[model samples]
Every structure is written in structure tokens, then in C-alpha cells.
Target chain A: MSLVLRETALAFRRAPLLSALSVTTIAFSLFVFGLFGLVAVNIQRAIGNVAERVEVVAYLKRGTPLQAVALAAADIEAFPEVESVQHVTEQEALARARRDLREFQDIFQDLETNPLPASLDVRLRPAFRDVQRAAAVAERLAALAIVDDVRYGREWVEKLDRLRNIAGAVGTVVGAAFALVAIIIIGTTIRMAVLHRSREIAIMRLVGATDGFIRRPFLLEGILKGLLGGVLAVGLSYGGYALIDAYLLRASFFTAAQATLGVAAGGFIGLVGSLVSVGRHLRST
Target chain B: MIKFTGVTKEYLKTGAALKQVSFHIARGQFAFLTGHSGAGKTTALRLIYLAERPTAGEVRVSGFSTARAGPREIPRLRRRLGIVFQDFQLLEDRTAEENVAFALEVTGARHTTIRPRVMRVLTQVGLAGKANQYPRELSGGEQQRVAIARARVNDPVVLLADEPTGNLDERATRGIFQLLKDINASGTAVLMATHDLDLVRSMDAHLIELQQGEVVYDSAEDAAGRQPVAP
Candidate 1:
């Protein structure tokens, strides 16, 4: 170890209270950053997972034949965006209605024949499961001569898309904000370290020590601060991830909670790294 | 050797403290700068240390003109000049030996060379046995002696003392002067700024008196106590 390192060790040994406070501040800030990070990650994952379940339903004309419905289903399945297609015959539709509304069967008892329409259930490929793709597939299917109508939870899907966009944008902004905060916190922490040892700096100047040699101790000090804060933040964030995931699982929102925790860890790392570096530099000088 | 020509230093509130002052000290020479308070003695000493640049004129020390000295050369110059202050600014936490070793450490003195050199200087100042003691544990006289040991560790070409004995008793003051005289006899020039007229008179050394800001009397006292170089 160089003289400054050796002396820096002595300086730390002499002032436990001051060093502990600085490190604690770093850890606390990192923990907060980690929490926000978790919120963002899970939102993204939940949006993606939910989008995969969305699909379009195309209803055929009331008198359409089984062969026509089957051919249409096969044709729809061949589309680049379509994942798969299932043809529902009028008989199947009637049976489903009978099972669902057995008590209301009297309301339709006067019907001479079932007027139920056969339909094609189109599941789009995962890449096209978003609102735009779902809407486009519905429009395209409705344009077909054999299709009479197309339907889906249009407003709900639109709202989900909007929410996903807003959430993703917020995640970006929050990540940037945390990064900036980490830099400021580190810089201020290091500045405090510098102020603490100004006398030693003056003495170093008097003793014919170069500026580079004088700054070494504080740099080491900042790194130690970062490492301590980093370890704490990482440790705390891991616990937070587990706790949040467990709560989400119990509440049946596990997917979102899991996704968000990943962001939390990233935030923790950023917070710890920036502060320790800045703190050490500020103190060393 | 040192020289001051047409040197002037001033602050806005405290007008000119040194004005067009001119003096010179030759190689291996000792001098006393005697003055009352606020007589620019501290300012004069400060200029030699390159702590304050002069408002005017040329001041030179150890062959380099300090007025024209750049930042890089300042440390080099300081390494060659030993300074002792009235407050005896020793690190209170360090051993007497460590305190002395600081001077050598800064100048890149090897660790193996520090121990014996520190011991020799402490022995010279009659503080050898107390090397392991910290400054706070020592008496005022002993602390001053430790300060002297620190100054001498670098084997500086010139030693400057500013009221070194202000905090000491009469006998202690006498001993401090004797130590300075012995160092000067061994060839390092000593410039002491003091108000101890009784001590100055008994020592029989060259004397320069400054009142207000300018020198009023210049008696370059030889070893036998007579003005040898008249200006």
C-alpha cells in the first residue's frame, strides 16, 4: 500500500461514525431506486403476456355450409399473422348456446330451425397479438365475402395497449431519473468526503506530495463506500423481489410482480455504483 | 543566500506593509530580524517561503528568484528551506519519531533511511529517549525540540524560525538559541524573526530592526559582535 492508502486506513479507523453514516445514506437511496425498478419490469412482462391471449373472432353468414366454413378456417390459418384457426359449425354453436342458457331454451322454442352462425376463431401469431394487429385481422376478415361480422373486446384491448405504452414510457423516464439521482448522490457523498479531509489535503500539499498521490486515498474511500452500498442495496433488493413476488402470487398477480423485480435490481446496482464512486473521489481530493 | 530588492507587499485595508525594501544575506550567514508587532517581519518570512508573492520587487532564495518561481518549483524550494513556527505544528497523534520522519517522507526519503536519520536529529536536539512519545505528552520545550528535529531531517540549506521561543521559559529559550547557533555554525543559515530583545542582546548576533515597515538599523554583527559589513 502507498502512504496515502495506509494513511487512509488510519483515517477510517479514527472516524467510524462519519464513514458509517455516509455508507448508510448510499444504501438507503439504492433501495428506493431498486423498488421503482421492480414496478417497471413487471408491467412490461404482464403487458407482453396478456397480449399473447388476444385474438379475433370472424362470424360467417347464417346459411354458410360446413365445407365453406372449413375452407375459410384453413385459408385464415394460412395468413402470415395467423397462428391457428378453428371452425365452429352452426350445430356446435347451437349446442354451446343450449348448454349456456338451458333455462332460457323456451325463449327460442318457437324457432323453426337454428339461426346460429358458424364462425372462425383466429389466433394471431404472438408478434401480432397487440391492439393494431388484432384490429387489422378483424377488418381483413370482415372484408371477406363469406364473413358477415367480426367482433372482439375492442375498447378493452385499446385501453390495455394505451396502458402498456404509458407504463413503458414511465419505466424509461423513471430509470433515467434514478440514474441521475444516483450520480448526484454519489457526487455529494464524495464532496462530503473531500470536505472531511481538507486539512489532510493542505498537509499533503505542504509535504511536497503530488496532486495525484494526494487524491488516491479518497478514490479508494469512494470505492469502498460504493461496494458497501452496492452490497446492501443488492441484498435488500433481492429480499424485496422475493417478498413482492410472493405477495403477487398470493394475490394472483405474480407475473407482473416478477417482471418488475428485475428492474428493481438494475436500479439498485446503478444507485450503489454511482454514489460510491462519487463519494470516494470527492473525499480523496 | 537570499536577496530582496525594491520589494513591496500590501493589502487594501492594511496599506503597504513592505515598501521598496532592499537587503541581502550572503552564503553561510546568520541574521536576526527584530521588530515590534505589525512590523512586516511575518510578511518578509512569508515571501521567503513563497507563500505570498510580493506586490513588487525581486526576492531570491537558494539562487532561484522566488518572485518568478512557478508552481512546480515551489515544492522543490520548500524542501530546501526548514521552517519552525511558534505553534509547533506537530501531528498530535503521531510519535515524536514519526513527526520528524514526516519531513523526509514527503521528499521521498526511503523508509529504511528514515529511522536512523530521525533518531540522529532527535539526538541532536536532546530528545532521543522521547522518540516514541506523542506531541501532546511532551512539554512545550520538548515539543519545540521535536519541531526542530523535523526541520533538520531534510538537511535544509536554510532554517527559518518565527517566534520559536515565544511559548518557552527563559532557560528553555536559551537552550533553543544555543541549538540554532550550533546548526548555523555547521553551515545552514538561520533567519529568526523575534521580539526578545534581551535574548537578542545576550546572543551577540547580527541584528536588523524594522519599525512600521522599513528597516531602521542594520548591524551585520560578526562572530566577535561588531558590525562587519556596512551599507
Candidate 2:
């Protein structure tokens, strides 16, 4: 081992209790930040997953031609905001209506000629699915020739806009708070290290060691603590997400397909955020 | 060689610690700096080591100006000379060999070269058997031996000792002096600052006495006119 690393390792080993104290303290602070990082990621992804349901539905005119219905769906898909288009034929619509009416036996006397018009369900790309953007898309679809009505959930879309805004605001505030807390904890930990090893530093200085060489090991220790803490926090948050997912599936609501889709995105965010925080701590003091 | 020209040191809180002091020690010369307590003995030693910048006047050690030496030059200047503290200043956590090797390690010696050099020096200081012993395991004089080993490890051109025998008994003091004499006999300049005036008188070595930061006597120059003292 090089002398600087060897000396740092020796010093740390000599006082394992103090070194462990620094590591765990740094880990706990980073853990809090990492957990929040995961929460924010999952929240956005969940909202996004549910928000996919908010699509512009182009209801066709009564007695509209088969060719016209297909043409309308195709035209809607051509819009930059539209992701995919599905054509619900008149017969299919009638069957679905009949199934609904069968639940209330008194309402459906008979399944006669299908009166439900064929409609186009147009799912939107994530960026254009916001309430304001979705409304613009709906208006543009209504302007189409064969569209009898351009319908998307005005109230539902508006509610989601509000909810998404609230989530974003909460994420920002919590992120900043946890960031401050983490920096303070790490700073205090480093300052404690400096104070404890002041004598060692003074002697090293006396022996011609530059300031940079002296500070390197402490910085490495800080980074290690942060990375380990990030792993732990990710584990805790994943466990929490898993438990929630399990409960949802047990109650016959959302399934495993729902959570796994967002897991990769969430994990990426957590790892990056933890690394950035640790880097900031290392450079700051 | 060290040359202090009109050098004066001041402590702001106490003020005027050392008056304008002037002297020179040539290459491979052994001299003793004798003074009373608070007579600027440590201050004089500090000037040569660049431990403290003089409050006024210029001081040069081994041709590097103390007042103007940059960061890069300071280490190079210090590498040429060695200074031992009065308190030994041995790390309590390190073995005697480790303490001696610290000097070489700081100057960027290769790890392969350091072990052998540390061993050779420790053996020279009579601490070869005690290389593995920690500072607390050794007595005051033995610990001082470890420190002397550290000072001379890199084969410094000049060795400065500040109150090195303060904690030793008469026998240990004699042993330490004999070691210093042996090192000097090999042509490495040795300057020991001490309070033992009787030891100074009996040794018949060159002596320079400082009283209140001014030279009071010079044995080498005064003895030049008198009959030469026995070797």
C-alpha cells in the first residue's frame, strides 16, 4: 500500500469505534435522502401509469361509414401528441353496452340492432397528457370531419393536473429538506473527523505532508458511507413499494405488472441522487 | 551552514522574544548553544528549521532565506537539515522503527528502500533490539534514541537538538552526548542547545553562549588565542 492509504487505513483501524460512528451517521442521513428519492420517482411513475388512461376518445357520427371511421382514427393518430389508436367497431360497442345493461336486468329488455356509434380511443404520449395539452389535443380532434364528439375527461384530467402538481411540489420541498439534513450530518461528521485528527494532521504537516494528501482518506470514507446508505435506503423503499404492491394485488386491484414497470426507473433515480449527494458532501468541506 | 543577520523574533502577546541575533555555523562543525531559560534557545533552533518566521531581519539556513522560501523550497530546505524537539515528540502509537521510518517516508522514499534504511539507523542509535517496541514501552532516554534515529535517518547535513537531555539521568545524558560526538566525528554538523553549563565546560568543545538573544562568548575564537584544548 502507498503510505497515504496505508496510514489512513492504519489510523482508521486503530480507532474502529470512531470510524464506524462516522460511517453510520453519514449512512443514516444519506438513507433518508435516498428513501425520499425513491418515493419521488415511484410517485411520478405511478401517476404517469394511471394518467395513461386519460385519452382523447373520438366518438363517430351515427351511421358513419366504415371507411370514414378508420380514416378518422388514422388522422387522430397522425397528431404529434397521439401515441396509439384503437378502433372500437359499432358491434363491439353495442356488446359492451349490452353487458353493462345486463347488470341492471330491468334496463335491457333485448339486444336489438346495435345503436352505439364506433369510436376511436387515442392514447397520448406522456409529455402531451397534461390537462392543458390534452385539452388542446381534444379540440384539434373535434375539428376533424367525421368526429361527432371529441371527448377526454375534463374533470379527471384537471384533477390529475392538480395531483401531479402537488406531488412535484412535495418532492421538491422534501428533496431540498433532506438534502440540507444530509449535508449537515455529513459536514458535522467530517468536521468531527478533522477535529479528532487535528494532532495527526499537525504532525504530518510538520513532516511536509501537503493539505490535499491529508484530506483524501476522509473524503473516501464519506463517499463509502453515502453509497452504502443509498443502497440501504433503496432496499427500504423497495420493500415498502413491494408491500404496497402485494396488498393491492391481494385485494384484486393492481398487479405485479404495475410495479415492475417502474422499478428500473426508480432504482436509477435513487442511485444517481445518492451519488450526487455524496459527491457534493465530499467537495463542500 | 546557517547565517542569522540582525534576526529578531517577537511574540505579539508577550512581545520581543528574541533580540537581533547573529551567528554562523560552517559545514561539518560541532557547536553547543548554551543559554538560561527564556534566553531564546528554542527560538534560535526554530530559526534554522523555519518553524517560525522572524518578526524582523533576515535569516538563512543552508543558503535558503527563511523569510522568502516558498512552499516548494521549504521542504527541500528542511530535508537538508534535521531538528529534534526537547520533548522527544515520538508518536505513542508507532513502534520505534516506524517512528524513524516516518522521516524517510515524508521525503518520498520508496517503500522497498525505507525498511532497510530505518533498520540501519535504529541499529546505529542502539535501538535495533527495541525496533518493535512502542514509545511507552521504552524509557525516556531510549525514546530519545528513537528520535535521534529519526533525525539522522535521511543522513542530514546538520543535526539540531533542542534540550535533548532534559529527561535523562547523568549516565543517560553522558551516553546521549557520546552518541552525538560519534555522529559529529563522522563529519555531520551537530548543534545541541542545552542548559548544562558544567557539561559544556567539561567537554572542551566549541561553545557559543547566548544571553538575551545576543552572543556573550565564543569558545572557538577565544581558544584560538589560548593553548589548544586536548582532543
Candidate 2 chain A, which ten residues in sequence have the lowest lDDT sum?
A249-258
lDDT of candidate 1 over B1-231, digit per residue (tens): 788888999888989998877777776678888899899899999888777788999999997786678867877888888888888878777889988887787777887999999999999999999999998899988999998888888888899898999999998888898998999998998999999998788766667788888877777534464544553
Expressed as tens digits, the lDDT of each residue in A1-285 for candidate 1 is: 577678768767767877787677777676677667656656667777787778798989877777777787888888999999978788888887877988978765666788888888888887887788898889989988899999867887898788888997888898789867865775676667666766656555554555556656666676667667656765677688788668765211224454344334334443454345544543453
Predicted candidate 2 versus true structure: per-residue lDDT over A165-266, tens digit per residue? 999999999899987776766666656666676666555555655445555555555455445444554555566557766875321222345334233323
Could you tell me every candidate's TM-score relative to the true structure? Answer: 0.72, 0.82
How would you encode candidate 2's per-residue C-alpha lDDT over B65-167 as one tens digit per residue? 9778976676677777777767888878889999888878877889899999999988998989999999999988898899888889878899999999988
Model 2 spans > 4 angstroms off: A97-116, A225-285, B204-231
In candidate 1, stretches whose alpha carbon ends up further than 4 angstroms from where it belongs are: A44-48, A51-161, A168-192, A239-285, B12-15, B204-206, B220-231
Worst 10 residues of 2 chain B by lDDT: B222-231
Q: What is the DockQ of candidate 2?
A: 0.35
Local accuracy by lDDT, each model: 0.77, 0.75
The TM-score of candidate 1 is 0.72
RMSD to native for every prediction? 6.3, 5.7
